[model samples]
Target: MNSTTIITDTHTHLYSEEFAEDRNEMIQRAINAGVSRFFIPAIDSATTQAMYNLEQDFPENIFLMIGLHPTHVKENFEEELNHVTKELARRKFYGIGEIGIDLYWDKTTLDIQKAAFKTQIQLAKHYKLPIVIHCRDAFDEVFEVLESEKSTDLFGIFHCFSGTYEQALQAISYNMKLGIGGVVTFKNGKIDQFLKQIDLCHIVLETDSPYLAPVPFRGKRNESSYIVNVVAKLAEIYGLSEMEISAATTQNSKDVFGI
Candidate 1:
């Protein structure tokens, strides 16, 4: 790996209000820092337009994914799924994503969340694109859904992956890559200790920006440029050069998203 090679932020949220004041400037900073690729995950209907605008503003830097987020899943999930399907039919999306079961925030909608997740998985299969998952305190539930839908066509990333080594292996078995982000750099973020045992080929860099900012920037709003810190952390943990980690994860992201 060389400094000249570009690093990809496999998962990020540039559409969030956190970047409203200087989204373009933040993106330019990221590009200047050698972090060029941006994979944007959809939250719900409310973000579609903003996502589209971001893509139009920086077509080459940003790629998009379409799907309903689990936290937003409710009795009206059918309508949300309809929006996702319509978007997929209307144009192309890099992947079907930010989709999965999240029980951490709300457990009341578990059943509906599962249904929406499964439906999105089916959609990913139908479109022949990878799926980007958002799992939270429901790895078993997520694995159950993947188990039911397991096939060569089923694959994607476990975004913001903070699961145990065994769970990470389980996710890989389903053809999914682990989306490593800010948490890996936390003091108590246990993943760093065992991550070296995992191959870099199965990893991808992400920030989940506007949410989990990496250390030194922790508790503050995150942005794409902050992904450089994530790359540096992985380099330290894996005992490899920053360029090595960047190249390997960027390649892994390309493999998963077919970019």
Candidate 2:
């Protein structure tokens, strides 16, 4: 990788236990590969300290976001939201996110999930921070909440965006930049079919590490270094060079996260 190539991973759970054994090495590999910036998202209170520890370990490279993940929204969700509230009131984070509707895990929590998503969106707006959304098998429900909260101040990345071109337009219409990740490299991942149609300015790169590993590395553990493969895939998709893809997506990430 070119030393001058700058790639920003807009969403990655560097705190994930999947890398617990070799966390430092994993991050170093990413940095060495030109994936120098990592934006970390909060899962819930359980993962807060881990996130802080990650930042402490790589203060300059890691940026944090605090929020209650939709899939983690349980009966005691009020308490979780309160935790998020307290954290936001307490310190600074680059964004509020990994919050959205996830019907793939549990459909029974739809009502609470929607509630949490909307409340967090309000929190993001209040804090004047960008949001990182995690939508899965619930586009309609997620879009419904986003529609209700649409505003000039409402802007963020639709993390791991996996939707149709029309849906891509809809997300962009709401001031969201699509988070393109490993899925784009999948032979059947539909996003690759029309990603070129979407402007580069509306896109950002991610790994969603320890999950959604790109092809050639598919079914294996994902790490930020693999982001180079995603960059290459995008280069192929857009008929550009890897460095060009890296530069554009990194800039788009800065546009969303403001750093």
Candidate 3:
């Protein structure tokens, strides 16, 4: 119910080493720019502590999620999942996230990735928390697992959504909100052209910071403050003012994360 110019970065790696030098200043800049809520995703066990630290540092502004990212899933994934499970039981996380299939990196681990993805989806349902998914060159693979697990209880964000309109509808049918990020502002970022056809309610803003910086800051290390670029792009795409896009998408994020 906060009446500020709410802009929520539904996905960001504040725990990334790239921001170690000036994380606090960068966060303050974003806050001053009205980018209030930040949702942090877990990459692996290695980043859990940093994620927790970010929350402690900005408990009211930053929210945390727990999961093993696709690229981080390895042969001994059972141990990694055990870590996720233990953490979920030990603390309250906003979501079970940054989880899904990624064939763009290593296809050899597809089976293990599918298993881990399925396991996390189940975990998310068990805890009644939304999920944040990461998909890359494996849309069909990700969709197949989601189809098998689809249910009224299954809902979350399709982080870094770069799929077609048909795929977007399919993702929505499965109760997933598209996590639009800096890529939406890229010149060749095709999704921007057709995003207007999709409902804004099914969209959420993200920076995926320390990576995928929007135009003017594109190709540079991204920070949460750069979300202003994303909001501007969305305003152009939707033919609405920046405040309109910010308010609508921030509400969409709250609906998903229950903030």
Candidate 4:
């Protein structure tokens, strides 16, 4: 990738404590590689202030999204939602998200998870902001909420989408662009096989980093800079060049985030 080419990690948690020792250097490595725009996803109130702090340090490059992650939606969900409400009212957020269902972790909280998801969707619509969805082992549930809430007002990226081809189409039907990341590059990652069938317009790039690192870096701590590996995989998958994939995904990110 060239210095001029722009890349966006539409879903990343750069504020995680994992980057405490080398956060500055890690960010610079990404910037140097042209992974310029980072849309940070909030897990819950605990990370909200850290997100604010990170964005202030890199005002021009980092974008923030406010929400309570599905896994974090436990007993105090109502209170957490209130916090999300207050935070959005305080300032503009790129989206309301990293929010959705995660049955893989805790099935008992499904009811509360669904409730939180709906509330945040309404919040997104009320604020007229896009939402970044986080769906894991709960595609059916996620699609169901999206179905009930479907409207022109609802749209955002389906972060780390690695579902079947039909599910990809279904997600797009809900006004969501699939967020492709290192999973696309994994040897066993199936998305690469059919991602080409999907149009570039509905696909955005992400690292989901400090996790989901592409092969060669797989099983290792991933970073935004490794996003180029994803770009290379996408280039191969789409029958386009690396530059083409980078530009297309970056533009797709702008479209979803309204950046």
Candidate 5:
């Protein structure tokens, strides 16, 4: 790994229980592999303290975002949104994120999910912060909200983007950067097929760690260091060097998060 190359995992849950046993060691491994910047996304109020703890432990490397994840939107969603509102009012966050529609898990909450996403987008605009969106099996639904919320202040990453080439362009239309991750390295991960068609500027790197581990590590726990594998895959996809991929995507992340 090139120590000079600074890889950024724009979307990762480092506070996840999966890393409880050796979180420090895991983060050190990622740093040693050149993944020095980590953007942590919130799941809900339940994970707020843990995210704060991660920031306290690694202040320089960890950047936090507060939002209620779509899947976590339920009966008490308004209360969760109130928590996000209060947190934003209380302190600074890099962005308002990990918020969007996830029909893959539940369709009954679509109305509430849309309401939460729109409300958070408003909050992001209010704070002049970018948003990190999570869209799973709900591109149409997600884009519907984005279309309505579209504006100069409406911008952020489409976290773990697994959309088609057209969808990629559509996301870019909304001023969103595509967040490529382990899925690109999957044998059936179709993003690799048309990724080269999209410019490197519209792309950023992520792991969505402890969830979508890349090949060789697939079906296993994912750590930030494994982002080097994603770098290698993007290098192959774009016919560029791994260092070039790292530099470009890291820059793209900074552009979105303003960090």
Candidate 6:
């Protein structure tokens, strides 16, 4: 946490119910620690309104992305996708995101997830917005879609990226920036071993709040403020100061989110 380095939580669910009690204070803590920007991702139609309300609350600090998350793609998914498209047409969003293939929860829906993921990638390109992908237990599937959609226009962060070094290179090959989070700080989070080999320009910071809290706070409720822990880990991995990590990643976020 450097006084002059501005930090950005490239992906966070500050609108989540987990912060229902002291959301304001939690955000303030992050801001005080130099994490001034919060990019909020849409889970599905259900969370869109909350996302809007969050943007209104901190219009200057909170940036909203529109998309239907992979895990939420299910029966009647067409209706959900409609909500995403309709909302995109209605207003401006920072990006089209929190979208990708996730087979961890229910492997049965893999096909539908890929369809939805591709549709949203198209939406992102149409809107000229970056995409924040959420890949879980489906790297091969996710990369396949990305490979098909590969173009100068298809670019964004691989949200909560947890993959091998080769996969990291492959993601960058598709014009994606890795959204590093709490996992990088885990002792068994193997990515730490080779993350340094990847350029800092390919990385961005995130908390995925209410989910992956960094070390020391691992297993606890994650908050935007905990992003400092992630930054610290990256500094160690990349052999840079916390300020350098924060500054570079914050700039990388601006590059991906376009703000």
Cα lDDT computed for each candidate against the true fold: 0.92, 0.93, 0.93, 0.92, 0.95, 0.91
lDDT of 3 at 222: 97
lDDT of 4 by residue, 6-96 (tens): 9888988999899999998999999999989999999999999899999999999999999999999999999999999999999989999
Candidate 3 backbone collisions, by pair? none
Model 3 C-alpha lDDT versus the unseen true structure: 0.93
Model 6, runs deviating above 4 Å: none
Worst 10 residues of 3 by lDDT: 1-10
Task: State the number of backbone clashes in model 3.
Answer: 0
Residues 1-259, candidate 5, lDDT per residue (tens digit)? 5568899999999999999999999999999888999999999999999999999999999999999999999999999999999999999999998999999989999999999999999999999999999999999999999999999999999999999999999999999999999999999889999999999999999999989999889989999999989999999989999999999999999999888
The C-alpha stretches of model 4 lying farther than 4 A from their native spots are none
Per-candidate count of clashing residue pairs (backbone under 3 Å)? 0, 0, 0, 0, 0, 0
User: Once all C-alphas are superposed, what RMSD does model 3 give against the true structure?
Assistant: 1.6
Q: Is candidate 3 or candidate 5 better by TM-score?
A: 5
Off by over 4 Å in 2: none
Mind giving the per-residue lDDT tens digits that candidate 3 earns over 135-241? 99999999999999999999999999999999999999999999998999898989998999999999999999989999998889999989988888889888999
* Regions more than 4 Å wrong, model 5: none
In order, what is each prediction's RMSD in angstroms?
A: 1.1, 0.7, 1.6, 0.7, 0.6, 0.9
lDDT of 1 by residue, 189-238 (tens): 89998999999999999999988999989999998888889988999989
Q: Model 2 — TM-score against the truth? A: 0.99
Q: Each model's TM-score, in the order given?
A: 0.98, 0.99, 0.98, 0.99, 0.99, 0.98
Best by lDDT: 5
Error of 5 at 114 (Å): 0.4
